[model samples]
Target: MARKKTDQKGDRLESIRDAHNAEKMARTTRMEDYLEVIYELIQHKGYATTVDISNYLNVSSPSVTKMLQRLSESGHVNYEKYRGITLTEAGVAVAKNMHDRHGVLAEFLMMIGVDEDTANRDAEGIEHHLHPETLKKLEEFVKLAKNQGLFR
Candidate 1:
């Protein structure tokens, strides 16, 4: 029937959309990790090189180079071979957001009596998956706890 065909077409489209979304999310996660590391390295040192990133992430230099090339093509980073990497404005914005999220999550864990080491480890695992609303709530909670002298 026509209705059956329509439904099948809709299902096929939905499946494709779901696949696309999943792939996009995976790429975003990887990009976020790289941006976070690059932000830290730049803050600590003067710049971030592929070798520095590979060493920091414990990944291969080739892998780092490949990702950097992808990031550069995507406009998140400006990469020149044999030179260092620098984030563009958009990349800096993403990195700053990620850094703030990490801090807020880590602070919340610490407020709840999680050990410093454990809090850092847990925050790293948990930060990327949190929704914006959840992060906002966590930030508010951290602020409230700090105001109430709950943090030592």
Candidate 2:
């Protein structure tokens, strides 16, 4: 009975991990782009208004409104129409994770001699497709580079 419980627990953990990864993998580029923008808006401005997001993303106001509606409905964002938008807890976690990935990729590229502009652009494109393991390795590489005073 105890052995069976341990096995069941392990299986549950594995299932949860798989589900989390699937959610990450299932995100479309459009969703990621929106999340990234929302993350930035929240970080920089403390709150995200439709007008602010539209201007920051250079997207039309109508497009921003449509996406925000979808995001709010999907539980990624909290909306109150006139009040503004905030990310739900799960959405906050996802945004932070994606932003960290972008920062890590950008730093790695810069450490390896890519120009800042190119690194930023490339990181934005590459972070979405990179496997978690590859990102782990890149993160380690960045840490090692920093330890070696490569940034100085």
Candidate 3:
């Protein structure tokens, strides 16, 4: 009986670990943060540089260099010295997804009367934490509110 109890507990622990791993995979990783910022900068301004990214993110150039190297190795970005960086296909997809999440959350926050700057700042943090289902609902609600001419 004790053997069976131990086995059951082990199984439960494994299941919990698996759930945590899945959740971790579902959300963005820290590296993704850099990629997302580059993606946004590229989209808005047509190019991104190490200095601009460093300034916007408030990180050192050395730190950004380390991450850019990792991202390049992971096939998420193409980095070169004295030249701008660009995202690969996989990187673009991830960046676009992150951007969409930020857009939806920011719009939702603004719809509820949050100021533009605060909403954007809050959305940047909230986007990483929101689950897919919750983000979907928030997007839908924001769309509906916009249709109703609410919060204009």
Candidate 4:
């Protein structure tokens, strides 16, 4: 039937959309992890190295190198072999957004009685998947809770 065919077409479209979203999310999460590590390392040490990134990410050195190459190609970083790594302007923007989001999420979880370590770990797990609107609302909630003296 034409109706049955239409329904199947709709289902196929929805499946495609879901697959696209999943791939986007995976890329975003991976990129966020790398950017956050680079940002944090640079903050602490004024530089980031492949070995440091590998250690922080718990990934192999070759894996970090490969990803860094891709990031460089994408204009997200300035990377040279055996030299320090630095984020490009676009990379800094993404890294700063991610940093703010991570801080708010971890602070919220801590206010809810989660330990610092656990809150940070959990924030990293879910940060890239959060909708911007949801993160905004959560940020406001954390602020309100702070104003109310709701947690230590």
Assess each prediction's global lDDT (C-alpha) against the native. Answer: 0.88, 0.86, 0.86, 0.89
Off by over 4 Å in 1: 1-27
Q: What is the per-residue lDDT of model 4 for residues 1-152, given as tens digits with 9 covering 90 to 100?
A: 99999999999999889867886755557877898899999999999999999999999999999999988988889999988799999989889989999999999999988999999999988787777899999999988888998865
Sort by lDDT, best first.
4, 1, 2, 3
Consecutive 10-residue window with the lowest summed lDDT within model 2: 23-32
Tens digits of lDDT, candidate 2, 47-125: 8889988887789989988998888888899977788889999788778888999999999888889999999999999
Question: What lDDT is reached at residue 32 by model 3?
Answer: 69
What are the TM-scores, per candidate, against the unseen true structure?
0.82, 0.77, 0.78, 0.83
* Collision pairs in model 1: none
lDDT head-to-head 1 vs 3, winner: 1
Better of 1 and 4 by lDDT: 4
Off by over 4 Å in 3: 1-29
Error of 2 at 65 (Å): 1.1
Top-lDDT candidate index? 4
